[model samples]
Target: MIVKNEERSLERCLQSVQGKVGEIIIVDTGSTDQTKEIARRYTDRIYDFEWIGDFSAARNYALEFASSDYILHLDADETLEDPNNELMGNLDKDFYYIRIKNDLGTGLVLTHQFVRLFRNSPEIRYKGALHEQVQLDHNIHQYGYLSTLILHDGYKDDIIKSKQKAQRNEHILLEEIKNNPTAFNYYNLGMQYIVAGQYNDALNALKKSYTLANNYTFSQKVVLEIMKCLHELGRYQEAVKVSMDAVELYENIPDFWYQLGLSYLEWGMLKDAEDSFNKCLEIGEEKSQELLNHYDGTGSYLAQGQLAKVNLMLGNNEQALEYILSAAKAAPNVTGFFNIFLSILPNASPKELLQHVIHIWPYQTERHANLIATLYQQRHPLLNEFITYHNLDVEYPISTLHYIFENNYERALAELNQQSQKGTDHFITNNVILLSFLLNNPNLISEFKNDISLSEKEAKWFKNIILKKVPTQSIHVNKALLMIWKQLILDLIQLQKYEFIDLLISATKQAEFRLIISECLQQYGFDELALEVLIECDNSHVNRQVYMTAAKSLIKLGAAEDALFYLSKAEGVHLDFNVLFEKWRIASTIDKFEEIKILQKMIQSYPESRWAKRTSGAILG
Candidate 1:
């Protein structure tokens, strides 16, 4: 057992590995903290090693003091999750290799048991500067990569400190790469850049590593990094091409299939995308088959969620909802499940989705409050009543924004004053709350202007968020209210009603305003006016919704092909009215029959929905 300044994780590691190993040799590499003191409780065979840049040197030095025949190394940050008989039984094996599992999250875990335990011999030494692996002779054989996984929680917070450690190792790896230019070294560098959010640097380094990789062993790792980098850069076309190339190289790897499917989806190749995602499900872990029950079963929350996202992107809301529901069932406590839950209700009331979110993740009240407030301001049906009756803790800055949105200026001001005076640096939160205050009650700014010490840039940033009413500014949105406001804004704008200037001003700043306005114009049965807004926006949320709405209006105008064109552009919004529009277009050709049944079904199912009810009534009439 090797230990250092890991007082944060030492006791947990020791408790897990205790009683299993015969001899414990903890090497303290200059711990300024109480790490060595804690190490004394476990074993007296603690040795001090001076701080050196070489991790291999310190680890190898610890091995010299070990008296056991088979040495099992344990990092202070890593723990043996199941200290059962299977793990204890495996220790007696003569093989140098042992399986390792990384218990990354509480429920969502992946196993990658590497050979960590081995006989203490000169040939078996540690390699690499960072994420070092055990080097063994060619004659040595590996044990099974079993189910016993190590829980690694060291990646928590401390990002700046971690980057500092990586920067030093990156310099050392660069020197090694200069001499040998090995595939592994470059791959490591790319991973480091990826963690650091240096997308361009990661891509360049990964591309170079792919060129240098001569071994199949490192090929999968290379492909994963390249695909991830391309995805981050939004180069979906090239990403899909590269992922296909990887699948051709190694078809068995499940991650490659997952990436291939995701990239194809990103590139809007839906049928091919669905096929790729299904292949990923087929190639899933054999042991995890019971957990996966669907044709697109990803066996994990993330994979299921990804499938839902793809289905949602293709305008298959029912399928998307199915995948997301499966994910929620698999992992009820996860926040990611709510992401898909909220998205599926693109046309649902914000209050409805917010209730669902808070119901699943009850502890996430802050998130719920924000969402509730957003819905209220967007004029989602009865969102104002929901907040007033529910008595949700609106002390938070965003909650105050919602209060202001409802014209409860007194309560909103009170919340802001309390938050601002708390002396806590609420930069982002404060900025958003103040922006709402400015929009709802401009006079309040003059009253609090002396108290608020905002920089020119910060003020400008706040102004942008306030003007755009971008969802980024605040999480709370009333879907119904937003839809209604969107309709009214479009009506007022197209009808040239200057009386709704305040409404237009409030919405003009929001990212989705133009799209909402465009849709309203089309819903009022004005295709040309809606198209004018479509020409301005490039696939933004409201833009896509409006474009789809435009298709319906075009069909009404007896332009069937033009309606189909708009429907094609409504890919990202996940709009479902395209099929209905098509049916209506065909009906228009006959001029004898109306597909009012479809419209009635939609309106009956979603009565509060403007689009559904309007289209349904129009067909009925």
Candidate 2:
């Protein structure tokens, strides 16, 4: 083995081969520390060589000192895992490829096979200045593989940063490219650039290597690297085209399909992305052992996560949950897997999703608390059960929200009072103000209004409740209050509480809240008030939901032109069935035949529903 400044790892490397190998030969180029001293304890065959930028030259120099019939080479940071007698009994093969598991710092393990053990002969020598390869003079048909595993952690980020290995490799590779000008040199340079996070440089070098590469294996490697560089550069179209070619050329590689899926996802081609990710999973499951060293294993957990994301995009929430659960089981410590699972919760039944989250609460309690609180605010059942099971009665936001949702106003107020004595958190104070308003206690609102630091939405709610006056001008609105007000307005509208609705309308000056008030007015058969509110409101503060609602209100009032204008504002947002049907209805009323066709196509692409089918029939008929 040839090494340089590996004092921390040299002894461990030597110990792994103890009693398993015939002789230990180490060639040290330059080590300022105790690397030589550590080697002296294990082997007496340690030799010194002058520092040159060529790894192959130093490796070849070390090879000359070996006196065994078979030679095994390993780095100072690598160790053999349980070397058995059967592995050493493989004397019939001229060379053997051994599995190397490289631990990448991104919580991933990559496995690849390398020819580490070969017969000792004068005809065989090492080649290349960087990423040195072993070359043999004659064709050896007796090559086989060994089950011996080697664990390597030298490529991890902390180790790489301390050693400055990428910078060193880049310097040697650039010199090699100048002197030798080989495809292998360019490939090594591209890989080094990749390690240095220089995607543009990596792309150029890998492209050059691809053009010069004659070997299929090297060409495939170059293509994958180029695809990675393009993906990182946000060149999704180019990445897709290159990955398609790669998938066609190297159908056995799962990484190509996985990358293609990622590119397609970025390009908003959901169906294509789904197909590619599924293909990756299929190939990965079948060929789990043929993993690449530079890439994470696809079928193990990474592909499962990607498949979960793809399924979520396709609106298959149940399928997404299944894949995510499997991925979480495979990699429970990976936060991304659980994050994807949380994202799919909104698409599922709230109660059922909450139960699932509760089951996995121990894995990530903090994350589960935030997510469960969000769904609980949407009025999902079992909040009390969740609070009791997790012993979250003493927590700030969850406890406060639990009391508010339970309609135990006295208990809720007492919890807020207790929390306020400890210190004031902005979110907790805001919850206290909101609960006070819900309880219809003007005294409580007056008490909390001065001391509580409120967000813009909480400030709006606070002023509206205490002052009982609406601002005549527009202000920046809080989106969370819009949802909260939406639920509250629906309840008030059911009870015919028009006086309280008017007070709400008068208190907040934001156009967004005015839109909500207008909806409440329309529900009470107050069309004139609703239309007046919509006209007085500014369009800048309105969102897609508001625009759609305004358009529907205008359509009901026989103002089709005004309805079309609001519909145009809702174009870029993700359209639900209601929005699409409304757009189609407006188009049909206005005799806009071209828009009818586009809306019909969009409706058909979405899942078939009663509204979708009826809308399609109306447009086509």
TM-score of each: 0.69, 0.63
Tens digits of lDDT, candidate 1, 60-179: 888888777777777887887554545566454434333444333323443444566676666677877565777654455544333555666554336336526667767777776777
lDDT of 1 at 547: 62
The residue ranges of model 1 lying beyond 4 angstroms of the native Cα positions read 1-4, 90-111, 156-163, 287-300, 346-409, 421-440, 447-502, 505-513, 516-562, 565-621
For residue 208, give model 1's deviation from the true position in Å: 4.1
Angstrom error of the Cα, residue 589, model 1: value is 14
lDDT of 2: 0.71
| lDDT (Cα, 0-100) at 617 in candidate 1 | 62
Point to the candidate with the largest lDDT. Answer: 2
The Cα error of candidate 1 at residue 213, in Å, is 3.8
